[model samples]
Target: MAKRKPAFVLGAILLSLSFVVSACGGTGNGNSPASPGASATASATASASPSQAAEETAIPSASAAAEGTRSYETDKGVVEIPAKPQRIVTDYYGGELLAVGANVIGVEPTAFDNPFLKDLLANTQDVGYPTNVEKVLELQPDLIVVMYDDSYEALSKIAPTVHIPYGTATNIYETVELFGDLVGAPDKAEAFIAEFEKRAAEGRERLKGVVDENATFGIYELTDKGELWTFGDNAGRGGQALYNALKLKMPEKNSNDNQTLQLSMELLPEYAADYMFLTVYDPEKKGEALENLQASAVWSNLDAVKNNHLFMNDFDTFYRYDPIAITEQIDLFVDMIVERTEANKK
Candidate 1:
């Protein structure tokens, strides 16, 4: 998600259903749902402990099962979602929604852009970016999952709209379960979480031999503005796999930031690490970005660049940070690391 501007829009309270949305400011001891974790720009990783982490997935209070709907707690408020949501139109979390057996009929541009999702949702209709009120209403989603409140009031007229703020769930594990619970597929969520962790474990084992325990990794992106940005552990752009799954150490500067930090060409050499994954956001601006960096005597001379350690990646593929996206990213990154390491040995 390179400078991701979430476009999950259009939501409203459904008719004949009582949706208890979290009030702006609530009582200190009220039964208000927990505050949604902030976005990458302002949020820190408030990951709960293992036991607490499981609980933080947020337990939903059951209601009206006879009506084929359940009262579920969301980052925003208590939502009345269909027990088996047949037609879902969501924004950023489409990948997670699909994972939890959601029958997604429509999606926003962000979800439609995800490589895996693009193919899976190929037959689906696009709701457009910033979310068109007309398209969402036309799609006729039984459940509308949005991250922002922008279109809530407008879309509420058509469906049961639920808001789950972006970056609310800290990790893929919590994210999957949260959606699973929302769509009444907890069994699938648990199974997927267990399997996903297993995949991470296997990926970790593969790197143990080839990648040095202390090898530093960094995620670099060339922006449309012809700027360079380096991301840290939780900043997406494959950071989850690079830092979390593989446990690769990031540069000391980034290890602390754990988010994105801009770098001037002169300063990039200082931030370049043992391994770097570079993706250009817009190829049209690559000359001004990567080419200029390559021409920079100070930057090109850096060991990471000269040693062929800075691998250029496709922007669209690299920027999709959903669970499905991250799964594929892990394999690609591991192969790249192993290939680079083998070449270094020679």
Candidate 2:
């Protein structure tokens, strides 16, 4: 979400969360989620996909439409997908599949880079960016999950194609449970939820003293174009960890019912919080703009910034919010927040 014009680009590619969080708080075990979901009960319009805005119901799959396949309801149309998809190809939502123990044969190149899901996708084929449609056909996947409908006609002709859309996957657990139903893995989905909650609860205990009840947080990115990009809960950029899993809060003034907001830097004071997470977008390529801002008086004087409550995060590391991604994020995120806050206090 760097160098983006406010009205034009909502944000960047969301993050992928992949590490496993265990009930006993032991590290290891399992993996990543991405593409956001809905938990705020915000209107469908508020949670529309960043790229395409269509229906708000958000894609959902259900019971037998055919002898071997089931009906998956999407905003575009009802697709008949396999009751148990054996060969799956996903882009951002691959983490959701992994959480439910679904067999994902292929994913876009980005999924392979996801630390949380990378090991799990060790053997998974790289489907290419813009989703190499040709590579997908060769993979002979039984089902395809996408964030958009651009290749719907082509992909659907080859096999059942379901659109989950971006921004719509904000409700992390709800969306994962829905994916479990979509893949006929309800039991696995339940277990994912159980373990994630247990782990997150443990994380909350860690933040008890560091984060108080009224403390507010903000997920922000200083775009190269001089815009302030703000994100909602579970909308990636560590949102799942800070706002959802650890149960932190975003300032109501800057927060809205939707997934993103790109506003002027002058509004920083209004959006200021007790603590802040700031990302420089794609720093290597677009960091000059942020450097200029950091030198400005406005940037130096923000409440959070002056108070040493500002923390930096890489754009890609914190973009994913799948069950797997969020689970992996808890311990790491908790430790980072605690360590950073403690250091600043000293």
Could you say which candidate leads in TM-score? 2
Model 1, range 1-346, lDDT digits (tens) per residue? 2332211101111100000010000000112122243334211112222122222222233342344887877656777778877678865556666554466777776555556555566556777657788998888887898766788888777888888765566556556657767887666555544544556677888888786678788888766566677765544567666666666888866642335667777677778898888877653554666676667797678778777788988766666556555655677888888888888888
lDDT scores of the candidates, listed in order = 0.60, 0.64
TM-score for each model: 0.77, 0.78
- Measured by TM-score, how close is model 1 to the native structure? 0.77
Candidate 2 residue 88 C-alpha distance from true site, Å: 0.8
The deviation in Å at residue 76 for candidate 1 is 5.2
Which candidate's lDDT is highest? Answer: 2
State each model's C-alpha RMSD to the native. Answer: 10.3, 9.9
Worst 10 residues of 1 by lDDT: 18-27
